[model samples]
Target: MEAATLFPARAIRLRRDATIRAGQGGPVIALADASLQLPGLPSRICALLESLACRDVPEADVQQDLAADGMPGLLRWQALVTKLDSAGLIERSVLTPQGPVARLRQAAVGRGPGSAVRAPAQVKLSRFTAIRAAGGKLVAERPGGHAHVELETAVTGVLAALAGWTSAGDGVAGLSPQLSRAVIDLFAGAGLLAPGSPDDDTEYTDAALAQWSQADLWLHATSRGTRLTSGYGGSYPLAGRFPPLPAVRPALPGPRVELPRPDLEVTAKADPPLTEVLETRRSIRAHDPAAPITLGQLGELLYRSARIRRVFPCADGQEAADRPYPAGGAAHELEIYPLITRCEGAPPGLWHYAAADHALEHVADPGPATAALVMGARAASIMAADPQVVLIVTARFGRVMWKYNAIGYSLVLKHVGVLYQTIYLVAAAMGLAVCGLGGGDAADFAAASGLAYHAEGSVGELVIGTPASESASESGGNR
Candidate 1:
């Protein structure tokens, strides 16, 4: 494509967040930690990007700006555009004769070939694409999308047109032909547009896409694959808007059962080797009903696996703490609730493990909802009988959310997995049975514990108990 068509109407510009600096190479474009060098760039081109540093420049004007140095027009100009595109530093505004319509930018660290569309054919919004109003602008993105766009609500008609498989040209709805095409191109470049029926290999029949539900794919992409412009890792997006959640949830008013702490120094020396713990770890579904896990054993397990080691001050006067298992940002957002059905010394009830205190607080009497949660665990396990206890893991979401955006919940789940591994290893070392439940009924758990579902809800579940002696023979089946 020629420069005029590639950067229509001088709509290309340096992203507001980007900076240009003189470097060992010709010039460097820096945004966040990303940097792109232009070793052989014409000096005229370098000045052009510098002029764009503090403001927007129409792409069509790029050559005109270059002409000041007597180096205007194609080859040299196109080379700079290619380098900027590779650096993910270009932001383009789509212009109609009357006004600017929308802007396209890179949301992820890399780029792709963009979505495909057969000319004069049916095109539709990809099932993974989500369009929503944010901060008075319409933001569109798809799972793992690298390209992102923000547009005024005026072009919402374009989205309405592509809501389903409509003719490609039909996508032109509320704007001039050029503006409408530009909007379509923005969505298409972001992989939010898909070839609809009558185009070979529709997204509906894509085997890889078929395996991903919208939520799963969204989580997977937002957490790992994509770097959203919204930000990542300790960004503290909510600092001024909302106060951070307490690093340690305040004590719930209830009868506290002070648990005994294990002698860590002695155990560290005498506990089974790491390899033995790793090898012997098994999800013992058959917990011994006759010989239930004891209060002392439960205390030791919690102390070894989840107790807080220290607390320290962090950004915005927020507190952060360390625990036996690793957590993203050391937020230690997870709170453990033990559902005791047959622990010998402790009463059968729902209890919250206070990590800071190394004690159990009886939160509620065993009720129908509690029984249902226990049953849910048993159903998930390959048990000889109901396990001795079920552990519900929850996150005080704001603990992570206050510090991170776009990937907060993802960090919470990862923290849960690490906590699960810690518990499994500790239980195995103690010759106790422990199994991590894949999932649980969050609504049921909230009802039983009387905790708010959104603020604090179950994110993971596990069962723990004394392994039935004979059931050890069936370990293979459980594994």
Candidate 2:
């Protein structure tokens, strides 16, 4: 609740979020979100953990308890401490008979307790480190951090003033003597601070790291490579609390229009050869206004490019599905919303593709937000006029998030790209134009559809129509 003023007082306690559950033989330490079993607990370890749970116990008293135990308590208590420290279950404080120097907690999961500062002449926060507010508290973290530290309200100003490399003697915050060591050690251990020495030439020159921005590296690390491995993948942490989202989003309610499904055998002979489609694939930007795309063409494109082909049951009564395009874990999260501006037969509006039934549901009338989307895609592709159809691709995040952890959003992005290629190739084969835009405004899409941003929002965009010319020039990989 308060900034740490000193190196945490040298006392030991369980973290507030951590609870000790006594089992028949396996004693489990359950954090707010997870419970795990670990080794090296003394027979009476639960009693000690119970005491630590209620209040911080002085280090000397703990040693005394162990010493007073059946046998002089070096090995047993040491084992428990080792297990707790490795699992980040213990909150340690540095005490001086009268009071604690600073109460500190290691909030990083899976990362070992941080190393000591080891006196240095000069230190500076790492260039990659970031301090920001999260869940009502200021957290200090570095990209791919091995440790995480919380800052005291006072420490904010302390770290701010010490932004540039500074002497170790300067002392952080200056609120307490222990503040400097604690701050230095916390940041240093998290890879949030580097020594003033010029030994980081390799770090700077690293080709792998050099290509990454701080945010990209953070996402990559947190989603795949970070040291925070406790819940990195699905352990179904919310299994009992929440039900998994259905495999396919139920079709949106709307002014529905049934679409024609082309006979596969007829389409097979009607389409160009695979090699011809691959060689002629183009990112066509401008639509042929004179010969605007027809509803029939649009329906055929949706059917061939995205319609679900099969469904099979999965665990927990959930079902796995097959579509023209592949998805991670059979989680077909991509949904297509076509904004029709110059289509024949279909009125100008925002329509969602009902892949399961091969139909379109008019969800909203085209308006300012839709115009903005079209214009944005035009600008992104440098088109002279809006394409006949702008297909906004969105993901039902819960579909992947419920089944996958850490890499859920990343997998959705991969699906977006895969589906884009699917549409591109299919459109090429159909003798129609399609171009995947580089990016889109998720907020604008949410405004247009009246959809919750987090539940389902645009991740990618594709412009489709009859090409202005048989050959379309490439821009931003429309090729």
For model 2, how does the per-residue alpha-carbon lDDT over 158-182 read when each residue is reduced to its tens digit? 5674576666666566545455655
Candidate 1: regions farther than 4 A off: 1-10, 18-76, 108-121, 171-179, 195-199, 202-206, 225-230, 240-246, 263-274, 314-317, 382-385, 477-479
Stretches off by above 4 angstroms in model 2 are: 1-114, 117-120, 130-137, 151-157, 194-211, 471-479
Give the TM-score of each candidate: 0.81, 0.76
TM-score attained by model 1: 0.81
